[model samples]
Target chain A: MIREFSLNDLVFLLEALRWTVLLALVAAVGGGLLGLLVAILRTLAFRPANWLALSYINLVQGTPLLGQLFVFFFGLPLLGVNVDAWVAASISLSIYASAFLGEIWRGSLQSVSSRQWEAGASLGLTYMQRLTHVILPQAIRISIAPTVGFLVQLVKNTSLAALIGFVELTRASQIITAATFAPLTVYGIAAVLYFVVCFSLSQLSQRLERKYHAPR
Target chain B: MPLVDLADVHKSFGAVPVLKGISLTLEKGEIVAVIGRSGSGKSTMLRCINGLELVQSGRIVVDGIELTAPGADLNALRARAGMVFQSYNLFPHLSVERNVMLALKLVRKMSTEDARSLAHAMVAKVGLADKLSAFPDELSGGQQQRVAIARSLAMQPTLMLFDEITSALDPELVGEVLRVLESVAEEGMTMMLVTHEMNFARNVADRVIFMHEGRIHEDGPARETLSAPRTDELKSFLSAVLH
Candidate 1:
């Protein structure tokens, strides 16, 4: 007798896909805010603050996301910091995303011309005033396209959470495939779901790039 | 009291001196033109007066506020002095009106409605009334410079500094900007200009100073300096530029 794939199994995978999206949202929002702070600290003139921020960025980016998830999931228990799979996955993804996002934003902020700062100073604006009034507005325009593009990568990376026993889309597919003995069919559906979400985000980012190129 | 006074100003960048032992004084409602070769520190002198470039050793007083002192209020000093740059550094993201109104609203604390009306008037003065909504990139070089002038005028400063404002424009486009400046001079607005346009400098400036090797070489009436320069350097510079 041949083993069969059922609609009930596909439905469970679809349900888990929702959690994947929710986790991506939590990671993106949480990571984006923390990353902005890190970017600012890295650019500030204070010596110790700048070095501390750089060390944080280097540590997070040097380690692999899978390894980070492992630490957060398995190592936390030894320290008596017990947390559920969902909480562990979200926190791990947020840390992973913050490093990349912080670097990207720093590049954007530095891209503004030195002349803009000179102009602001000539007008006697303080450092913070110049940043808010003159520099950030221009830097934000240059940053939008790249920032949205990074969101797509963040969404796809959510699959790594499955390694830590999170029942997101990939984990759900693995469970179904073990029972049905149909790895190809079950994993194919999961790939399709991920592609749909990631592809839409990619298209949106491209459209924004084009719009930014068009004359105001 | 003189509106601006500089005593033995000295500035350098990384050991290469830009302005060395410069001193000058300007009374209210005076127009002085600063002339120099490309690297003679004419632009740096103008920048120092406005607090854009800090001097290493000097006493710079504008409207009785010592610019070189540690406790001086730079914003208040800048409020009374305005500068126009060669590149016409209007904010690209803001419209012409907002570009002019920014200092009015932010620095002067003018109400939005009042600042808007003042900005429109300044734009009209520069012959850009119809282009109030236009972005900086949409305008030509001359138009952009005029808008920059309007932006400065909106601040209602007591002294204006023009740093090679027309050097970046096309030859044909220079006249319109000069004409606006001529009318401004007629209104007795105190201005210190760094310019290469000898004719405009001769026609409009109350006094002209020739700078060389990071110091002033000659200072005299505009006609006397342009027609009968005292030194061979000024003579050769005029001959090469005019011919």
Candidate 2:
């Protein structure tokens, strides 16, 4: 159509960014809950539970994100589940985020000194009490940096949703580029929007880290 | 009944046996100093008494709780027996008062108000009353060790175990921590301590247990045991330590 690269196109891209933000939020919350379970299982001394968590982590981390998205988008129809692009993208991104977040959190939890456990035990704290009151508070501090880093990665990874015809930021950019014949302008603006999100996340993480680790 | 009873206690880490068939009894209000060379099972014996380490064979009964029984409630036993370590292991994230009060609130289920007052008193007892609001890293090693003692004391335990508590302190800082232990002894608290402080053993402890190669080489009145030894190992150990 060779339309003008106008304000309406910019508005459309901005609107598409809203979907990207929402998808990232859904993935984060879903992944966070599932990742907590994974981390606890991996850190526990029970062999069966540890093995189960390890295998799940390996399965998610070993496969490609695109393959997972494809499985959910295409494979679900074969199973008669009939999920749309939204469901498929959300599920696959969440699972992908869970494996990385789980491993990062498990490392943080275990990094706490063993002596701290003994100290808590000798003071008569129950296992759950020790975990909640002592271990988790310390581990939260250790986990902040890597966890935020993964979130930033997750935000950028939302672009992959466009491949499955989901109308997120990248897909919106492509639509605008085809109409206006302005690929450079459309993708450049899209890249800048991603930078804004990731940079703000990093800043927010630094503030949280400072707040938690500050001396009493 | 003895406050603590360890009968034919044996423990091993993987292939290496640490304590070999050790039998001991501690009467109420008795302060026993366990002295030995490194790797002599002194610390392990203290640890086993508090259920920190499991003994492969034999029995440990602390405050009438049978620790060797299957599914023993170790938390209950530990409530009656407090332990202090060489590194002080204070929850660094908490202030001195909170560190002392955490178990009181969580384990003892005391109200926050009650825990606060008890925390104050325990910190005062250790001569760290002024440092209540300070964090662990802000204090000197000796100060941190005193705070550790206060933290344990706040639990109102019947017996306390000290695992080389002053061994990690600077030479000058050792005196302050030992002084806290002396006052604790004066208050008639039953305590078992693994220590390298020979002089404190002679002066403060009611009994001395010298361990050699995972066995008790000598056990007797502290002054008597320090002055005159019964075994060649004890004589040599005393000479080597005293020198």
Candidate 3:
């Protein structure tokens, strides 16, 4: 006997959305801050810092997100530092976001023409001054569309957090499907919910892309 | 001591040698023009003096500071030596006012009011006061180059290096930029320039240097050099451009 999805199921999934939004925010704020550091280290002329940032980006991008999730959620327990699914998901997602965004930002930062650096340097501006006055301003303009695009990916990626028993949108949908035997109704709604969030963000990125490209 | 003295300077880009044992000197307030065909190391010599390019061997002294020394203060050196490029490398993101005001506020640490006023004065000097709020893209190639000149002049540098500053301008636009350079010259600014405008050199430069195959083939008073051809290399060079 299969039960139709009651309002309770819809309500529960709506509640899980808070976790989804919270996780994405945590990743964005944490990842954004650390990602700036990673981007700087990778782009700077200093060798050792560049190597360290390169390794960080490789380590994150080379392996599966699931592997990193377990390393934080499951593997960390063996070391006797207990962490909940929320903490582990936040940590894993933040690290994941940092590596990806750092590479994106590094590309933007490097995209500022070498001639721009020479112009700034020729004017007797120090490296830091050159970056703030000229390079970073141009780089930030180049970075906006991609950075916002990554945020949309990040929102969708939060669904993977449910695998670790975090009870986000996917997990909540799974629980409803199991109990009601209405995978069609429950999953359809879940899909709509995810689409709504991701689509809104994707549209925002496109709008911003157009806005940035529009002439002054 | 000369304001700038380069002694047997040699420079390379990876495997290709550009400036090979080049030597030159500029006294205070001398307006000298360097001329040569492409790949003759004229521009590289200017860059080395500004510390924009490093030499593999030999020495470059700008304003009594040896740029060859490892820890030489580049900013302090650059502060005294302003350079204008053929490409007019103005900060595209900044307005004309901000572009001229950048080094003043950041490097020299001038107050906002002081920087703004000085920037206005420099822009007016270049006859671009009406376009002070304009972006680089909003202006013509000639106007942009004038802004570049004003940006450099705002620092009140003791010496200015022009790397074919008029080469990128349209044929009609060339005169406007050259006129700005003329006023700058009239102000008694010490300047070293690489230019293809033979007439500009004839009219404005006190001295002329003709570089050939990484060496200065001919150098003398601008009046005499433009009129008489001592070397076949220079004679051919002038013949190629003059027509």
Candidate 4:
């Protein structure tokens, strides 16, 4: 039975938005930690580890995120591995973020010159020591902008959580519109919520870029 | 045995042979200059001395360690062998003092206070006492090269390899760096350099080695080699570089 749209419906959408925000936060922290390891491995030039990290990035980035979500959500249950939608969505989204963040950070690491490596080597610092004391500090400085930009993308990509039945903003809004037959009004507000979150993050990345990019 | 002994060390980059069976020995406190045209493998030889490049054959022993042998302690060998490059590859992101102190802290495990004091002293020795807090990009090319030298010197290496360190400097700036080299030589620091400055080689180097086609064509006392060349390659090289 069709029901009339009311203020309660908007409140429900806002409540669902909390999950979206939390998912993005989890993805950011989790993806950042894992991606840094991946990025470092990619730059280290160790034959096996480097090749494995590259293949991992390629496999994740080459396929659709939706396909990744299905593997965790729908496909796992058929093999008797029961994963709830919340866990499945989190896992897939984090892996997606890791792939992109790893690639972005790898670029930053490589931007540090070959001369830096030679200088560090001449100083007799071990490869790990050089990375920790010399290379990474510089890479982290150059990486901040693109890293923050990826976080903004992470925030928007969480709308896909709806597919796994996570009941985030998009899913909640869709639920409300089906009952009230108010698709435009319900979805427009959902769109606005995404815009607000994404716009602020882009602004944050820009501010970071300006702060670090001083003219020499 | 000499402090550094390369017994016919051969190196190639993929299919291209760069250093063709080169052997040399360096005694403590000796300043030897290796002069040659570009692609004569002078820089590659300098790199091999410090294990920057691996050899395809033959042997290299530095500071009692066989670098070409498996299980050689290259990092420990490199600890005592310092090198300065032609491009003056200073750590652009770090301050002059930080650049100098990086190895002391990381490799030597020196405390910050000790590293700081020693780095400041090295910087002063290089005549960059005023540029301690400045980034490399803020310094002139010559000053940056000196900072690179200071960075290597802070490690207190027993031997130094300078691969045309002053070649990238301006004509006016070249004097300050050469002066630093002269002082280092006088202080009895063992050094091997590849340079184009004939007068500096004649005056400062105890010996001169003229390389052609990846082999040493002439090796003798600097004055004798500069004044009286034995090979046609040396005569032509001296005339071309001088003129």
Candidate 2 residue pairs in backbone clash: none
Q: What DockQ does each listed candidate score?
A: 0.54, 0.69, 0.70, 0.65
By TM-score rank, best first, the candidates go 2, 3, 1, 4
Chain A TM-score across all models, in listed order: 0.90, 0.97, 0.92, 0.90
TM-score against truth, every candidate? 0.94, 0.97, 0.94, 0.92
Assign candidate 1 its CAPRI class: medium
Per-residue CA lDDT of model 4 for B1-243, tens digit only, reads 799898998889999999888988888888999998899988888899899999999899887889999988888888899999999988767889999988898889999999999999999999889999998888999999989888888899999999999998899999999998898889899999999999999999999998888887788999999999998898998899889
**Model 2 over residues B1-243: C-alpha lDDT tens digits?**
998999999999999999999999999999999998899999999999989999999999899999999999999999889999999999978899999999999999999999999999999998989999998989999999999999998899999999999999999999999999999999999999999999999999999999999999899999999899888888998899878
Give the higher-DockQ candidate: 2 or 3. Answer: 3
Candidate 3 chain B — worst ten consecutive residues by lDDT sum? B17-26
Interface root-mean-square deviation, each candidate:
1.9, 1.6, 1.4, 1.5
Specify the highest-TM-score model's number: 2
| B-chain TM-score of model 2 | 0.99
Tens-place lDDT digits, model 3, residues A18-61 = 88989999999999999989998997889999999999999998
If ranked by DockQ, best first, what sequence of candidates would result?
3, 2, 4, 1
Best by DockQ: 3
Model 2 agreement with the true structure over A19-40: per-residue lDDT tens digits = 9999999999999989999998
Per-residue lDDT tens digits of candidate 1, residues B1-243? 999999999999989999889999999999999998999999999999988888999899998999999978888888789889999988887899988887788788899999999999999999999999998899999999999898888888899999999999999999999999998899999999999999999999989999999999999999988999999999999998899
- By descending lDDT, how would the candidates be arranged? 2, 3, 1, 4
Reproduced native contacts, each prediction: 0.40, 0.79, 0.79, 0.79
List runs of model 4 lying over 4 Å from the truth. Answer: A1-7, A40-51, A179-185, A206-216
